[model samples]
Structure formats: C-alpha cells, structure tokens
Target: VEMMENVSKYRYANVPNLDAQVVEIPYADGRLSMVMMLPNREGLHSLQTLFRDLSYSPLASTLASLRETELLLQIPKFSIESKLNLRPTLEALGIKDIFGFDANLSGILAGKSAQIGSVLHDAKIEVNEQGTVAAAVTGISVIPLMGSTMDTFRADRPFLFAIVDQSTGSMIFAGRVVQPTWAAPSPLG
Candidate 1:
C-alpha cells in the first residue's frame, strides 16, 4: 500500500457542492495539476452523484473558484493506472464504422487497409510531496483533462480526483480511490 499517512500543507479550497475541501498539487510547469477532492463527510458516492448531476461545466467553474487556505493535508500515496480496450465502449457511442469490417481509415494510412482494430487508453499518475508526476498515453487513442489557504483536508477515506488542464479546463485523467494500497482497486481494479 502506498501510504501517505502523513500531514503536510498544500493549496486548499472548500467546495460547497462537492462537500469536500480540495488541495492542488501543481506541476513544475503550472499548466497542469493534481486535484484531490476530500469530502467533509465519508460519502464518496455522494461526491460522484454531485458531479454526475452537475456535469463538467459546473466542475470547470467549481475548480476555477479554488483559493488559498492553510491546510493540514493527510492523503495516501497512490499510483493510478488503467488499460481499457475501447472497442465496445466506442461502438456504444455510435462509433461503429471504425470497428466494422469495411471500416475506412484510409486517411490514416496512405494505401494500407487498416481499421481501428481496437483503441486502448492507458493512463497513469503518481503523486507525492516532491510534487506530482503524471502521464497519459492513448494507444491510437486520444484523451486534471488547485487549492488554497489554512484548512484540514484529510483524505483518510475514499475520495475522487482528477488531473486537469488549466488552459483547456479539461480532465485528462480522473478516478476515485476506494483503497489506498491498490489505487482504485476496490471497485475499478
């Protein structure tokens, strides 16, 4: 288990809708960040339901509202990685032609006959005191894509998180942790 059972300060914010205080772990570049959402209560699914109810626009706005606060942060050390074959999921989104027998990916390869046999999205991230290191590689695929002053944002329980792109306001990588040792293994592994 990646245990981050230590206390430290970070940029924090109190978000009303999520009922969680947020802490931003910025990258060296500042264009991206690791946004962790630690709910004031132990209701992780409630946080999920709120996001599902509000959609992402509200999320982008919510993130924009973060400010500095003194925070006693207690979060676990975890690495999140996932590999998923996007064929069925893509097809469900009306992207069938690409997976069809006569699919046309001509524009992709000059004359070679090639269909998008399968699209896989592999993403992983690691976060710690020295800052956060993250990367996402979408195999033939494509894809936080913030916080403030004195507050206690202890994530000793399940919570949600995302790696967002500041400029585009898109979540490049996002997931929730139900277990500390196994990243998102409780439900996602």
Candidate 2:
C-alpha cells in the first residue's frame, strides 16, 4: 500500500516515528513503576516537558478543584499490614500518600524543589557542613531528639535518581538532576 511504502521510506530515511512501548511494573510493596522506551532523547524530553506543563499549568488547578470534593469524600482505610508492618520506613513516617506516583505530583515536586534550590542559590547563602544555610534553621534545632542530628547529616548531600529492572531488581539507569527545571532550563540547551 502507499502508506506502507511511505512508512518504509521514512524509516529508511531515519525520520522519527511515534512508536514506543510502555511497560508497567507492579511491586509487592504496593508501588507502581513505569518504563517508557522512546526512540530518542528528543522524544523523552518532549514527554517530560509535556508532563511538566500539565502539572503546573492553570488547567491542572481547574481539574484538581473538580476532583477535590470527590477525593475528600473518600476516607482511605489503612490496611492491617500498613498499620502493623514495619517495612519501607518512609511509609511509616506518615508519608502514606504517594503523591509523585503520577506526573502531576512528580513534576510539581521536582519543579518546586528545584525552584527552592534556585532561590537559595541566587541568594548565595553559605551552606553549613550539615547542608543548612548559615543563617537558616528548622524545627530540628528545637526538637532535642537524639537521632535528629544523624538525619540532618544525612540530608546534607545531593540525591540520585535510578531506574531498576523490576523482575531482576537490577539498576538499568542512574542519574542525578542537578537543577530543577523551575530553577533553570537544561544547560545543554
């Protein structure tokens, strides 16, 4: 057919096509992961950009408002395993709600955190050994908890993001986002 011929021609000419496979990984730990196989970096970048825009755009506000009432009506019941089991320490820390599971919260958090770091960087405030701004302080100062110092020390460093193969539990990709998009566009551009 003409369409098949055109597609073959385009493929031979190295023209990009919108053909990618998305794999969903479900964990026994109640976490869901997604892996998208894109043809090139451009496709990945565009997808990321679209996700960012959808998350922070005014349209999200309207959609969120519509869903807020429905969400509020549903009281999440904690499972026995969730209450009594002591795995995934972060979950035990009252972070039961997985906000970044979707593009909305993930993009917003990435953007906002990047923005915070940018503002701090712009201010040029000196960071202490514990990664705290020289003049800035938090409740940890008044908490007087024994493990608080350890937590603060651990939080003083940058974090990395990684993608792992669900079946094999092997790391497929690892990288760090130095600056959030809200803080600045990519330096490569």
Candidate 3:
C-alpha cells in the first residue's frame, strides 16, 4: 500500500527536516502515492488553499498525477479540531469522495475516552510539577443534609472552546464559558 511504502521511506531517511519536500513514488500495484511530513495548522491550511487553486491548472499531467495518487496525512493527538476542518478544505480542492470519522467517532478511533457527564459538580485544585497552580478540574459530587434532605449544585467544567486550523494544527481562537452552551456544536457531544 502507499502508506506502507511511505513508512519504509521514512525509516530509511536518517536526517529528515521539519519542512521537507513531499515524496512521490509508484507502487507495484500500479498506483501512485504522495508522502510528506505533516505540517502544522497554518501550513496545512496553506497547502489546502494551494491545492484548491491548482485543481484547475492547465498542466494536465500535474493535475492527473494528483488525481491518481492517495495521500497519507499524519497528525498528533491534540490536533483533532484541525483535522476536522480538512474535510471542507478537501472538498474545496475538488476532492468529492473523501471519507473520515466525525469528531466523536474519531476520538474513539484514536483511543480517547469520551466525556459523558451532563454537569460538572465538584472542582479540585492542585499544583503541578512545574510548581504552578494547575487549572481546576471538575467532577461530579453529591452532598446530603442531616435533617432536611438532599440538595445538589451543578458546576462547570474547566475547558475552553477553541477554533483551530485543520491542516497545520494551529489554534486560531479560544474562549472560556461558565457552562456548556448549545451555541456551538461539540463533536464530543
């Protein structure tokens, strides 16, 4: 497979640079594949935009080569949002039949546990190894009164909403909120 060939080449190259050129090769199965080191969010976005622009280039051979080849894009764990954006970007590049997992499914595919609570009730604070006060983490807790009855309070999780570039793995914007609002759709949800 193209992916396997790219892995072999990567193993052979001893001193690869951060922004190395993409490699192309023809496989025994008569298929072409392009291999390149994955870029950060900005770089990925730039590449997507560039491909979109070149989709209708006059150079038929270049365009044909791109059309015939498969791509293996690698990404780290934290770049989920950016990866999500790649779908629309690919569509803009004239790629009509692309496939990928949705955010929640992708998380499970990547072996990440999904957050399944409706409310964050208790918050715990601690210091990290760097000696800085770690951000408060929220959990669920319940308290009971001696005489009257049961009462509970819903708390907020310590997380921020962030916009990211899918290609190059960059956080474009971020904001914190008091509660989980439905204003934005969460892939995790």
Candidate 4:
C-alpha cells in the first residue's frame, strides 16, 4: 500500500482493545481534522466491531480524548470513492413517489416534466502524510537510533480515518484502508 510517514506532534488516544487507537491531524485552520483509528488487531471482524462501537458512541468521545504527543507516524496514502444508488433506501423511507412517472418535479426542472430516475450519491477522499488530500504535507525529519524506544504509530495494517469539523464535532467524511488498490511509486521518491 502507498504510505504517508512522518515524525510530528499528533493528538492521540489509545481506546480499549475492542475499539482502536485514535490520532488527530488538524488542518491549517485548526477547525478541522483527519481523525485516524488504527485497530488493535487485524481482520474484518475487528473492523466490524470497531465500527459498531463507534456508531454506538459518537466519535466525539474519541475526539475529546486527543492530546498532543510526538511519535513516528506512518499511514497509508489512499483514495477511496463510493458511489451508492439510494433509490431503494429512499423508497423504503416513503419517498417512492419521486421516482414515479407522474411525479411532478417541474418546480425544480424549470417547468419540465422530470421524474427522479435514481438517487445516486458519490463521495471520494484522497489522503497522504499531509492532512487531507487538499491539505499540504508538513512532515518532520529526524534522525534516531534504530533500536531506540521512540513511540511509533504505524498504520501498516488495516485502519480507518475520517475528515471532521472540530468545532461542531461533525464527521464530514470517513473511509477505511484495508490494502493497496493499485501499485504506485512511493512519495519519498
């Protein structure tokens, strides 16, 4: 997998083993963040349970646990895109009429007869050692002994991350990194 490695101050928290470890990488404005959760163990079941627990408890608790600390951080550099057809979901929620031929959407179509065909939603996020994809990379370079006891947070395994608005504690976007989607040249080059 592509990687984003760096040595920098990170806002981190070690949640229960059943959950995952948290790391907060704030944006330039300081009002937003890239919150990463590294599972304590490997596998799909662990990820499923971690997400389940996160849904049960708002990520705000994890966000609140952030405290600044230095570490040797290494994370995957990935871009994830999700395209979902929400027609069934909307229809299940009593929004079926919009998809009917007789459904009137002229008000939104400038007097044209346009019924909803399908509700398709698409979202993509590209992240690297920097903050978000759009954010700049600001990694620190330090020389350390190979066997030294420096703290390290390496996401060489499966992990999850979310883009959040810190002020309102809202998750703007979230995704998982299980493996490399494609083979690419390293960023260090």
Error of 1 at 154 (Å): 1.3
Per-model TM-score, in order, reads 0.73, 0.17, 0.19, 0.83
lDDT of 1 by residue, 1-189 (tens): 543322233456777766667777666687987788776666557666645644643667777777765344456667778999988998889989977778787888788776777899898876654446222111121110124333565576777788888788788888888754333211110
lDDT of 2 by residue, 38-140 (tens): 2223334544543344345332222222211100000111111112233355455865444233324445565542221111111121112222111121212
Colliding pairs, model 4: none
Q: Could you give the candidate ranking by TM-score, starting with the highest? A: 4, 1, 3, 2
Model 3: how far residue 17 lies from native, Å: 22
> Which is the leading candidate under lDDT?
4
TM-score of 4: 0.83
For candidate 3, write residues 40-134 as lDDT tens digits.
Answer: 22333544543443345322222223322222212111111211345455567875432423225343447763432222233222112111101
Q: Which ten contiguous residues of candidate 2 have the minimum total lDDT? A: 1-10
Off by over 4 Å in 4: 129-139, 147-149, 180-189
How far residue 71's Cα lies from its native spot in candidate 2, in Å, is 30
Clashes of each: 20, 0, 6, 0
Report the lDDT tens digits of candidate 4 across residue range 1-189.
666555666788778743678888777787888888888887877777888888777788777777787766666677789999999999989998789989988778887887888889999887754446224234445535799676676777777788899889999998887764333323321
Q: After superposition, how far is residue 162 of candidate 2 from its true place, in Å?
A: 0.7
